[model samples]
Target: MKLPLSRRARSAPLPGIVGAARLDIRTKNLLKRLRPGDIAIINHLDLDRVSAEALVEAGVVAVVNAAPSISGRYPNLGPSILVEAGIPLVDQVGMEVFARVAEGDTVRLDGGVLYRGEEPIAAGVVQTAESVARATQEARAGLSTQLEAFAANTMEYLRRDRNLWLDGVGFPDLATDLEGRHVLIVVRGYQYREDLQALRPYIREYRPVLIGVDGGADALLEARYRPDIILGDMDSVSDMALRSGAELIVHTDREGRAPGAERLERLGLRAQVVVAAGTSEDVAMLLADAKGAQLIVAVGVPQSLEEFLDRRRSGMASTFLTRLRVGAKLVDAKGVSRLYHPPRPQVWPSVLLVVAGLVAFCAAVAATPGGSGLLESVSAVWNDLLDWIRDVVT
Candidate 1:
């Protein structure tokens, strides 16, 4: 027995939803140009949930992925999200579609089939809720292998970067003074904006040193707070964030190849370089620890195994070591937000009472025998002062 098509599937018009399409080879770059009702053509392989969420937020009618949405390496949730959001996802449409179809072209989708017009162009596997669910189940079955690989990679990284764990190796001297101060390092991760909002009061009160890691710099700017120090490889950060007066620390490869620093130099901007073999988020933490920050509050840090995998990291070796080194000083943004409650003011009631007391005192003074005489004296003094002011003006 065959199951009937879901309401989401049947609701889509038979001749297919026709819309203007915009193509971008890079999904992240594509996001900037996306608009509601526009079809998004992207060449993303094993598309992650974050990219999928961005596409959903962009309000695209359908997605045409040139590469496989899920290659079965792990249970990626991106394709599932699209199908659930009622956006048709056409997977593995081939790379040729990029050149064959021009940008801003009107495209029509009839189920799994794509058409430029009367002419049929590209056809692909249309992902459905049921299909995505099956794929996800199969992918989850292969997690043991992924866990083994992660463990091996972690050990290898531990061996290579042992010096960092034991002693703070190659920690650079930054111009920003961080001694005995709270350092807030922002990483672009899940719910980062909301976490920043939750920490707004803490930021206003403590006035911590803000460190932005690459795209995290732009996140800070989005929240209307300027970063004091921007650290990363500089690939994802915007030009406006770079020019936001934050001191730039470009993370360089072990071989001293700094693509980010070079980019800044070409743009006639100065940047400091730190050669490290770990993720930039780890670099930011280690730098803060070395600089003697009293506390390091991290926003949008990758805390879970899935989050680490989402970043395409083999394991969380660098992150684990970085945390070990920072020890007691490092705290997650969520923890601080939960534990610290801003004081609720009771001063207004006292202030109102004092104001009422002053009014009553004035009323009592007015009722006294000398009140009229005092008022006359004050009025005469005011008149004399006014006359003097009038004379000076004249």
Candidate 2:
């Protein structure tokens, strides 16, 4: 169940519960015991929009997210969905705060006293969900007001700058259309070799267009598979991969040039440099999605905020927007790999085969008793030599 945006300043009543709910369940399931006007304590205020349906129906008043779910990166599903469902959401509370105040803690949100639990502990409220909801609303409203200008500027950035979005977009949405064409996308680092091996069958079967994103080219080459198109900032990719016989799409920045682009030109290879302000992976995904590729498979790509943090990138908002725009046509290779249950040779079959080989060897030994005796003599002689050597060495 999902929830709608709910506000603390509601004319009517609140949900049944009035405390933190770190547990994520259907609003109906949650509302079975939880009443309207309850405060929800979640790990992070990011819930699937579909999941929010229940909360809105139940009329939850406030919510608190433990981690930084949306520091303005991807859209905050929890707070946004909750507030849209008439609920408020808070962010960045200490981990101990939830434990300090259990299901029935008396907490203050939106200037209202909510008795979360009768015997719950005390959790000092830093920022209330009510305040977060108001802030989120204002920020969204401000963005909406500037949407026209932002979109216009984004388009201008695309045109003047070699946006990653346009790289390899000549055949936008033409994956299946490129039927019988072998299109290879490259990804370097670990698991990509396995990825190529996994995709080899598909590559051989479908033979669609191939585009490698940076080091992805190196991975392809390692697997003895040549790439037809390579796209990325070219930082992680090898010089050999950059020089590989493929149509290179150098991902540039807003200033219209980057070292990668220059390197491609220096190699006498004129790349379709895309000057976009986003991650190379995002640009590659958007390009493939727009190119109408029958399928887009991402390998070893950062999928979460933690992963993004590992890379220390601050362009998640741009990347998230790109993903939102083209998420439908994309397929993450990792997710597909999770579902792979390749048929393993049955233990019985392997055992039978081993037994049969052993039996055949024994039969051969029996059939050639003289030869078997020679083999035994040779083994004895070798053992004797080893024994003599061991004594002498000692």
For model 2, the superposed segments whose C-alpha errors exceed 4 Å read 1-184, 338-394
lDDT of 1 by residue, 1-394 (tens): 6446796676655588888889999997888889999999999888887788889989999999999898777887688889989999999989888887888999998887789876788888989998888888887788787777777877787787667556667766778999999999998776799899999999999999999998899999999999999999897788899999999898876787655666797778888777776788898998898888999999988777666665655536677667778899999999999998888889999999999998898778779999878877977999999999999999
lDDT of 1 at 181: 99
Residue 41: error of model 1 in Å? 2.1
Measured over all alpha carbons after superposition, the RMSD of each candidate to the real structure, in angstroms, is 8.9, 16.9
Using all chains and alpha carbons, the TM-scores for the candidates as numbered come to 0.82, 0.42
What would the per-residue lDDT of candidate 2 be over residues 93-201, giving only the tens digit for each residue? 6466545665554565542223343333323233445555655554454444344544665555455433344444332232133332323445543346666677655
- Candidate 1 stretches greater than 4 Å from native: 1-14, 255-259, 347-369, 372-394
Clashes of each: 0, 61
Best by TM-score: 1
